[model samples]
Target: MKLPVLYTFRRCPYAMRARISMYYSKISYEHREILLKERPKKLYQLSPKGTVPVLNLPDGKVIDESLDIMKWSVSVNDPDSWYVNNIDHQLEIISINDKEFKKWLDRYKYHDRYPEYSVEYYRGKCEKILDNFEKILDSEKFLFSNNISLSDIALLPFVRQFSNVDIIWFRNRFINLSGWMDELIGMDIFQAMMKKFEIWNPFGKGEEVIFNN
Candidate 1:
């Protein structure tokens, strides 16, 4: 039987991370495109934590967090490889991605909110993460393993968001890391999954748009 669907908002960094991981995992689901400003009752019911990228599992279980969704999907589809193979390494990268990188990313993206924080201060914090990554990326294709592992997949959406906050600066400063991104987004799965869809036009049963998977 098909799993109970995924409700996603296309442009959300959290949703983007979930979708990309789903793509990599070869997991397909009913894709309900939701408008964040007007989240559907079905999604609100599934996860009153009320976040985008909510996954309604077959047994009526729900996972509302993006990182949790990535872990769940990878555990099922890419287990013993992308994530499960090198457990400790996979964990360490996720720790930095969620904690250090995300903190700096948020501050950098919304420096206006943190009036006491200068863009340089936040950018410096974010740059430090990138610099650490550059050392690894300079040698391997991904952070955890040579191939695209859960660590790479998990950190990417946030990194993409963080870089875009100052595109020119990022592009110039991180020329070496361009290939790392190019390799991930270059996948047919990633490209096909990221396509923009129109607002809620709720599809009928069996009419779910599965993003070409």
Candidate 2:
């Protein structure tokens, strides 16, 4: 069968979330692990910008954005209702995470790039978002409620990125948020989503790596 092709970088938070959502939805696809520096020619052919987590459907539709890939995956088969309930609010929170929080996270992670501000200042900006999440998690197990939803999966990868920057500081600061992250990260689907794959070689025999097979 000609499954949808997924061009992904293992460590990118955007790609990670896409993979996680696809795994949760149990949608089978061809996984093409790519290096950002040495991206395959096919990726650029499919997407001019050549970003990771680009899904090329067998029907010739291309979805380059990670969030859109996630939505498409769940739309195919959402057994856990990840896309349901308070969709507008969930999408709003995801937008904030992708736009506002990610900016500070990048600055915080690579503080030396922006020497105008100290690392702490950038972290402080990220913490404001974390603090809001902490308050929400304190009230409920997940972002929306006890059950995991689209918002939780959409934002968890970025939160994981934030915690990785300074895990000690993150663990020391947010108890509720830490537990929430731990719960999501410890899930079986997360482990499957993180399974490593050899870099795809378009020039080689074109080996098919089935995602979550």
Clashes of each: 0, 0
- TM-score for each predicted model, relative to the true structure: 0.88, 0.96
What is the model-wide C-alpha lDDT for candidate 1?
A: 0.79
> All models: lDDT?
0.79, 0.89
Best by TM-score: 2
Q: Mind giving the per-residue lDDT tens digits that candidate 2 earns over 23-54?
A: 88887788889999999999999999988889
- Top-scoring candidate (lDDT): 2
lDDT of 2: 0.89
Q: Per-residue CA lDDT of candidate 1, range 117-153, in tens?
A: 7999999998888898888877787876677777787
Model 2, total clashes: 0
